[model samples]
Target: MRNRLVFSAFSAAAVLAVVWPFLFGGQLAWRDMLVLDYPQMTASNFGGGDLFARNAPQDGFLSIIAVVMPATWVVKALMVASAVGAATGAWWLSNKELLPTLSAIALAVANPFVIERLLQGHWSVVIAAWLLPLIAAAALNGRALLVWLLVFVASLTPTGALVGITVALVCMNKHRLVTLGLGVLYLLPWAIPGIIATFRGGQDMNPLAAAQAFAPRAEEAVGTLGALLGLGGIWNADAVPDSRHLGFALFGLGVFACVLLGIRSVPKRLIVLALVGMGIAIFAWLAPAAMAWALEHIPGAGLFRDSQKLLILALPAYVAAI
Candidate 1:
């Protein structure tokens, strides 16, 4: 009960922190904010086409919500919920895994990757990130496959679906086949369309240029590193919210402590996972040639033109590692 309270309090705090600017009579407008314009929500809009074909199942879910509710409320609710969910999910995972409570919450909710994505107005990515810790816990415990299936369905984005499925399979040691089956069934909605689209010849894109364009900027990469340790901030000067300096400082301290703990106590597998995730993120920055080559030759690599997005896969590992 005490743990639950702590979790709830921190979760609420996390939500408030993210929305502080809005609470002060600010507005939500920037790249991708057009989705929040409620007037655009319509059946024709929602049913314009299959999401699987577009490889954005998550965006489809958001479109449906926009149609059903006022867009402003939907956006506000999602922003708060995503932040709270990420913190709560981390708290729950930490409790289940015997990790540090505060450290987990800090890394989960305020990670640079999450903040960057949020600032970038990538709501679907943020939502998927918030769900990752819970999904990891569920998979590890061999429960909630159905719930996870639903989450994957809503996540819709290839990165979200792939990460969720991969995590579940890796953690579900006792019920591998069952988990795999559920994942397949849940993904069919998107998979069938994606497969059909692939067969029909996908849209033309310069894979190499796309890869380079979306790779994390240097400051973004530094922020990703900081986030791995609970010090979440972005590289873009314009993206940082106002008056977050104290928060960033405290987060850095928390990250430093977590790093010490990780070196002393984290499991080998988790450390390896973190390194692999970091390596993938770095590959896009440090080895553009290799990244471009992989993007060109690898079948599904094209989907992750914004390879920095792969950092989402690392957050859960970082939490678990700490």
Candidate 2:
């Protein structure tokens, strides 16, 4: 009980340290994150026309909560809540020693992946990330309902859903059919509507063009490999920290090496998961022609255009191994 209280205090402090300004200062909005005093849900938010349902349930969800609180506060609350929630999840994953627990908390809530996405205003993805480790733990315990419930929350965005499903498959290989069914059901809100919109009203964001435009990029001279090694290769250069271009960017390579060496009783499937994630993260950049071809030929492939989110698949491995 004492340790739990200590962790809770530490986690809250950690979250407030990073996001206190956004909560108390001027309106906190950036990139895709828009803030309005009152956000209303409309027909378009459901799906159809030139728009994809990427922000489907997210916008609708906020609209519902905004009825009781301001949208700015809603978003701020989300950031703080998700970060602290992630730390709690990390505590469960760690060895439960003080030092290891704190280290896992730091890596889970304050790492480059969280930073880049937070700076990019991807609160939805951040929420999914907080749920990642929890989902895996539930799966290992054979908690089917918990797994599906977590995946449903994560699926508010397509990328979040994909990584959640990938983790689910890795952890719960027993009930493949049931897992797949629940996954499809969770994704139906965005996936089905997205396909319908593409066929009927044309695309607002062209997948082939988006594939080329949003390919993984380098932070500096070390190139995309360096950026991704640090778990911070967001296509939007402005979303990344300026320090990412510095000489220390290669520091993550050390973490990667340590993680590989540290693997012991962790599932071998986690390594495969990490490799598959890296492959997807680099796919568009390394094979532009193939990426373009798939984007053109495959329906609803736009979801993969911003491929970096797939890196979340590797995160569980990193957490468990380290």
For each candidate, give its TM-score against the true structure: 0.76, 0.88
Question: Which residue ranges in model 1 land beyond 4 Å of their true spot?
Answer: 1-4, 19-29, 36-55, 63-68, 71-79, 95-100, 146-150, 220-257, 263-269
Candidate lDDT (C-alpha), each = 0.60, 0.74
Candidate 2 Cα errors over 4 Å, as ranges: 1-6, 25-28, 67-74, 173-178, 204-209
Evaluated against the true structure, the overall lDDT of model 1 is: 0.60
| Cα lDDT tens digits for candidate 2, 158-224 | 7878788878877885786888988888777777777787767664546567777888878765678
Model 1, range 264-299, lDDT digits (tens) per residue?
A: 444443455556656677666667777788876776
Model 1 TM-score relative to the real fold: 0.76
Estimate candidate 2's alpha-carbon lDDT, on a 0 to 1 scale.
0.74
lDDT of 2 at 245: 64
What are the clash counts of all predictions, listed in order? Answer: 1, 0
